[model samples]
Target: MDNLSRRDFLKASGFIAAAFALWRCTPREVTASVQPAPTPAPTLATPLSADDATTLTRTLRRITFGPLPNEVARARAIGLEAFILEQLNPESIPEPDILAPFDFETLEMNAGELLRVDPPGRPIGELMGATLARAVFSPRQLYEKMVVFWSDHFNIYIRKGIERALKPVDDRLVIRPHALGRFHDLLSASAHSPAMLYYLDNASSTKEKPNENYARELLELHTLGVDGGYTHQDIVEVARALTGWSITRPRRFFGGGGEFVFRPRLHDTGPKTILGQSFPAGQGVEDGEQLLDLLSHHPSTARFISTKLVRRFVADEPPEDLVTRATQTFQETDGDIAEVMRTILTSDELRASLGGKLKRPFEYLVSALRQTQAEIEPNRALFRYLTMMGQPLFHWPTPDGYPDVAAAWMGTGSLLARWNFALALAFNTIPGVRVDWDVLAGEASAPEGALDTLSDRFLGAPLPEEARSLILDFLNTLDAGFVLPALGALLLASPYFQYH
Candidate 1:
């Protein structure tokens, strides 16, 4: 049998054209209004019917990168509530030693130690590899998901000067430690992170000329929404309050530097007012601490954080009622992240949003690797695909992070990149990444049976009737040797697999 060319692959997989046609014809706008209140949280103790099992599958799909058969079985066996509760408290779950095989030396180093490395880019590469490893292989799936969430929430661009060294430190010390902790503690840790300070120009801030870059983002992007009711004057005052929050400069001979340090001399000794709250004179780091307290506990912060969480896990435009409930939980729990996630995850809103949220490039890639059980080297060969798909890890230039909306990722170029990736991965063409069709598909030899097996394995359920028919027809056209890889590529690139 001749090896299939790219043109032959696309021609054989007619479902891509059909899926694109359906996508273009369908209205992407969601018009559902927020319910006045949430329906009572579903009781999980009931027996599992087909519909119940499907719901459980959807829940696992949303929370983890993608659902494995074992995970799906575990969720069904443990029941929904227990599964969610167990994921929320990640410490109780024993994690697989996902990083044991990789020798990423810089992941454990401080910024000062990273700066001294011979090749400056190695640390960033290792960090990205570790991140992909965790997402693809970690058994503590929800915890890894939250790590991605907070990494975006408090974004720091790695390409920025000194940030290349500092971001790994920030990821290890600041983001990972506090991802599932209290929001206040997370905010405080980020405020003091040298990567964040340097990336946002707060490291150079002084009493004489305070930089407002970090302060503006702190208010607008990190905590409060754009409509969170603050003025430019508040930004100025907050920047003033955050003055002297700087990192120690790396010395030439000694290996001591890159640590956060507060300079009392550079601090604005005078009193200041922020968000209508008064700060007395002679305050130092307390100014920033109090400011974080004010923002973290504010009603607007609760709403803002809740709305973003709901948007991430539920829908593009968050349902107002779910946001309200999550906000109430946030306020009630003093910004406890786990509890707020519990409120949103257990609500009726997420249940209704099954297959509604589109996977961004990173999610799409990681989910594919997870679902296929691909053995990956976690190197630039794999990372380059994400770069091509428009979401290079830790590399979004702005503070807003990668956009979470489906529209941001639906470009023709991005879609083509996804298709190319599906082909490469399915054919085992990517260097250092391998997918075994025999193991993944099992004893299914015929095209029809293989299609059914692949569909159930990838989608966590049978494909829709129309989609199944289109794909099976495509498979029937291929020669016996080409059927499995073609079917695998077609399913991975299909729209059914694009959404969670």
Candidate 2:
């Protein structure tokens, strides 16, 4: 495997030669994190011009969960464009290592089975655990990142009645597979998913009393964003067009039970107008289907989605040129997410926005796990911190999803919370989370050597002289029993680590 380049590794996984007759599974090797050399190669602390190094680190941070010790080496070896391409075409990559400790049974269960499960938190726990595990360990970092982004985009509360059951199924069938695929495909799938139907109360919608909850969100949140020029009448018209697009009863245990169902009897068979486009009387499910088609391809929708992508990848305000370029790519490519992402990742604006965005709490936790290479078997306590920081997975409680910028998360109290977790993690006191400081330290010893190792592993470079001296002075106050772990914790808690 060492001799094989990433391309060759993918090509050779099934056979020695393409013309040869053979079959094989994608090697389990593709899933696990590739261990770097015990000692990092001797290299300049900062190898490029200040701006270029900043851009490179920013690229790695945006694409991956966080920076790894060997991230720069690997990206340099492959070239940044090629690295971005690999992540964009994730099918060419193999499946990630399964979370062996997790059963995943509840996620796979039918809606009826999930609704019947007596205990509630088990499904939520499994889903959250899997989310953290994948972000920290999967080799296909970009794909996992997209899955998370979409989960938020189409958020549903796990504790909301039948949503506790429908949400996991929605994740598996609708969100994960299409996260990096076409926007139209993803939009269509979410429109037909049971969890969404129930959570938004579209299942109970009828021609007699149309529920505008799903329709309003579909226009304002899902496709055409709030400023996408939709009127209240358009929302009502969309509701009329979507009447009877719903799910079967959860009590049904057979056939397409608890699945999407269009009850023709409940559908509005009268003429309707959405965004000034008219639907003739006597139409049924096609009315809603047509509405989905219109919104997915609307020019406003393309701009809205593109703006959000640019904001997430580059900066909160988003550079106008990048947005213009990305919106053109989105409309030209018919919302090909991969191409849109490529446009943003390759842009000068994204590079220029270095260190401009702050890490969200969810990002902080996962980055901690990835940098430490901790042994993570999901436990209840591990997820409690997520709840505490107010970014609980699949629990945003509204359609807008969690905020992506820095100001929303900069409270002194939240900073203190992160510091506490960082110290606890390094001390090996966080239940079910374990870090191997001895293995991480290798042959490095004492204050100077340990700080060097910690900086190399976590920051990919040394800290400022003042910060380094501060940590060293603090170490002088501690005993041998606490010195090593406490120092590592201090590194994790540093302001540098807090940002990227």
What is every candidate's alpha-carbon RMSD to the true fold? Answer: 4.6, 13.4
Model 1, residue pairs in steric clash: none
Q: What is the lDDT of every predicted structure here?
A: 0.83, 0.75
Q: List candidate 1 segments past 4 Å from native.
A: 1-50
lDDT of 2 by residue, 1-500 (tens): 22334543343232222111100111111111212112211111222224555556657876788867666676778888888898899887676556766666676777777766757667777778888888887778888888988887888887888776788889889999999999999999999998999889999899999999999999888999999998999999888888899897766344236789999999999999888888999999999889988999999999888988877777656777888999999999998999999999888776655444457888888988888888877777677777676688888888888987666776666765776677667767677789999888889878889888877667655665656766677677666756677777676766556554
Candidate 2 off by > 4 Å: 1-55, 69-72, 252-256
> How good is model 2 by TM-score?
0.87
Tell me how far the alpha carbon of residue 392 in candidate 1 is from the true structure, in angstroms, after superposition.
Answer: 0.2
Query: What would the per-residue lDDT of candidate 1 be over residues 1-500, giving only the tens digit for each residue?
Result: 12557766565456466545434433443322332112211111111123876778867888999988888888889898888889889899888788899988888876777888868899999999999999998878899999999999999999998787789989999999998899999999999998999999999999999999999999999998899999999999999999999999865246658889999999997999999999999999999889999999989899999998998888777888899999999999999999999999998888776666778899999999999999898988778889989999999999998888776887878988888788788888888889999888899998778888888788766765565677677677666767787789878887667776
RMSD (Cα, Å) of model 1? 4.6
